[model samples]
Target: MKTGKRIKGLMACLLVTTLMIPNVAYGSQPPYSDKAIQRVMGKIYEPTTVDLTGMKVVDQAGAPLNAELKFMLFDTTIQEYSPEVHANNGVLDTTTLIKGHHYILSLADANYEMKNKYFTLDATGELPKDDKTNKNSDSPERESFDSITVTKREQTLTEEELKKVNRIPFCDDNNGAGKFVSELSGTVDMPDMADMYINDYDVKFKLVNQYETVELTVDEFGFLQGDMIEDLNYAVVMETTDPELQNYVLLQDLVTSKNHQEQGENVLTRTYTHYTCNPIGGIYLADSSYEEGQSMIEDCTYAPLPSYSKKSTLDGIRVFIDRGRKINTDMPGALFKVFRDEFVFNERVLEETDEKLVMDFDTINMHRDEICKLPHGDYTITTTLPTENEVQAVYNVDRAGNKVEDCTFTQEGSNLSIETTSVSLYNTVIEFKHVHEFEKIDGTEPTCTTTGVNEHWKCTSCGKLFADEQGENEISLEDTVRPLAPHKYEDGKCVVCGASDPSITDPENPDPENPDPENPDPENPGEGGTSTPGSGNISTPGSGNASTPGAGNVSASKKGATAVPATGDNNPFALWTILAFASIAGIGSVVVTKKRKSN
Candidate 1:
């Protein structure tokens, strides 16, 4: 038994040791440790439980509220408050809370009065009841909270202020009536209304009489209600106390509308729907008695009606009178007149003028520039020269500055130009050449007696000559005298000169030393050659007298008479004649020989 007791003691010792070691196993420990509990306590505190059913709330109208109601909770224990909790339809229910915590509840709304209540929540949940009555019970009574009512009031104006309003004068009016009216409108804001309301106010229209102020009332939306009278002045004044209301008051002038009748005398109305609050002051009417206001006046008068005369110009014609160095002195004094139909519209004397004559034409029913045109129908320009001077010639000059004679003028309506001359004015120069008498130069005829040169005819005015009439003619010495015929000899007897031989006899006149042997008569052949009948006295050939064969000089002894040869040892006429014949025959023989050689 002792052994058993020792064993029990050992088991009891192990049990004490186990108990002293502290329970640290996973399943043996509490669900939460003290450190974990302290950490949770740092994050959150205990809340109070309170019932909010007894709290009362209402709107300004003091009826049961149907809006969202909010409540705020204040905890006395933790010295902190909770976020506001909202209740729909103004009803609050039970809420969780902390024991032994002092709490306060409050509601805030702009449309309603604020309410506050304080109560303590013991360990048991309980709340204090609201004991306040409805605060709107003693407020002023209203018909409906949704809309407000407004009343109209009219104010009178003084006489001086009425007259200060400007009226439309008769002079300023297009139609002869002097009528005027003023129109005005504005916007106002009503309670609880979001947008601006237009033309919703009272208006007081005032006017000045002879000595007093008169007022007209407008009970409707403050617009000018009725038509105004003709030629009447008016001013508008608005009355309102609302901060959002605008005043439209102005001095105006009005006239009658198209629909207004004269019998009704209704003035026109103009509506000004948009306006501001700035005050429009008094008006001032214009004085209509000024002289400038008259529509019609007297005509103006002056000495000369700004007269302008007509003139003409020759565009391309430049008259050079003296050697192309000076213009004609009488050209400037030339007169030009223009006529329209049968009436003379313009006339001008070209005095101290250049080639161009500019004039101002008094056109009765036409333009001045148009009336200045000449030679078209009745319009003409006639140039009158001085009595002492006349236009001798109207010629033009070429590009080389040379005179072009007989350049006649061509008239196209009134435009005159030189024919075949340049059309440009600068390229044309008109000249009036001087006229003078000229002497004719009789030409001499060419002479055949001697060598002479040709003579040409010429004029004295301008030393110009005609073409050559005759060429030079030379005289031949061989042709100055008659030539003797050549002698033909047969059987030592001369045939032409009736000599035995031409070399030994004279043929011009028969003589004893030289005689015509062919004519020697068989009877009386030695009787000194009895004189042939009708034959002149025979002499030596160079001595004289060879009678012409046809002048009834002939020898009766011979049928064919032969003349005596010349007596001179050298007869120049015979020698020259022989030489000429020989030359001719020699040339003919040369030509025949050449021809034969060629053939």
Candidate 2:
């Protein structure tokens, strides 16, 4: 048994060992140990100093460099210290770096103008890969060190140096760093005279490099003054946000003056005055690409740039007046007027001699003329006819020659040509006609009604009223009648009309000698029968004088006789009281029987 126990213990030990073997083999190795170094050799390694020799320096063209260029060596492991070294004759021979550690080789002076380069040393003779140069194997190496070649960096010019070489001119002696004035002068020419003036517009100048913009309003002399940078190029843009000028095309130009002095002072001045032609006008006959109809003034000068022009031809419009055939008499004298933008062109009276009025309307071509020509804008034509009178009614004719009732003169703008259809005149004749006149015929005075009619005068000539025929205009005289009040009956008599209700009977006057005792009459009590408590010959439950428990009885036996009240027979709960008493007695008997049997 002891041996068996020992064997069992041995088996348990073996099982535990087997379970721990995998964990021990796969566990993490100690930090910085040989096994740890082997595990992380490629990914991480200890930093140690290694010797570097026979390094050479050259230019980008592969020529050897002879100047003494100072460089810095940085140990990535201990980044705080960066030792300086000097390279001469394109060689650096005395530098010790770490194997498996990263190192940076950079020019010691920022003015050296070269980017820094990094290298990692490995004792296994593996070269580090460069992101730009990759791995180069063209150089011979020493027994204890590696050789590398570095190139000289390109130099960058300073700001002042750049300006000197480029020969950029400035407005001021201090490299154009002062306030300067900019003057803009120009003349605008339009095809048609407009209310717009030179002072109504503005010019904007923006310096591209400085990110500055300023707006200058034009003066009455067609000149604007503002501040600008002397050494910078400007983008001169002329525009207007006014609602009246939004239709005009905007002008823009890039202006740069290499000659600081144009004619005199240091002021940068330019002249650009060109009108933006309005393109709204009549149809054009020329090619759409050419602007033909409108011409600019000789004095108007632009920035010697391409500009847009508008050309158009003026077309004639006609106006016609006619007297409607519907009028039996001559047409009334009427005034006709034509206006364009508050400018009246024609105003005349329409008479028998002057049948129609003809006027010329101008239409401009948009392609040729930059703007719409005069007399082509909004036009309003108004006609005034005679007012309606008792004898005749006057009206205006529509486009289809239909007579318009109550037509009045309108002053709204329209593009349609004036042409009257027909005017009609009728004779004034008085005629009597029947018209509705509401007369109250039923209610009180001043009541409204629609049942009565009165005679009203109507004109057969122009449908006008001159007189009203007299009619019954007072309240209705039929009657002030109402429905009878509903009847109410009480005790066989109506309470409202004092009439007898034959359907209702009086209990007090019921059939004599056969009257109902339940409804006894107060005045004649003996006629029905008095309901005295002990006098009625009715049998009541538990009315005898026998003394018994559980019996519902109340006796009046002062004279040795049990007299039960007749009202006891009318007790509503008499049956219920008797049943309760019997139930108690039966339960008591049942209990006694059960107890006796148990004993």
* Candidate 2 lDDT: 0.33
Local accuracy of candidate 2 as per-residue lDDT tens digits, 124-211 = 3344433223322111241222334454335655655433321223223223332122211121111122122334444232322223
Which number leads on TM-score? 2
TM, every model: 0.14, 0.18
**Per-model CA lDDT versus the true structure:** 0.31, 0.33
Candidate with the greatest lDDT versus the true structure: 2
Q: All candidates: CA RMSD in angstroms?
A: 56.0, 40.0
How far residue 378's Cα lies from its native spot in candidate 2, in Å, is 82
Give the residue spans of candidate 2 off by over 4 A: 1-47, 123-599
Q: What is the lDDT of residue 168 in candidate 1?
A: 25
lDDT of 1 by residue, 1-599 (tens): 00111233443453344335432232133234435433333322333354434333444454445666555565422324556756555445446665433344544333332323434333333334221222221122311121111111133335554443222222111333222222211110100101111234332344432123344333233223333222222222334454433322221221111112212344322221001111121111211221442211100001111112222222211110100110111222111111111112332322222222222222111211111111111112223222222233444343355654344554434333333322111123333333323333343432323332333333345444443222123233332233344556786676545556735434465565545564454443322445443344444345366643343444343444554543445336877999999999999999999999999
Candidate 2: residue 236 Cα off by (Å) = 47
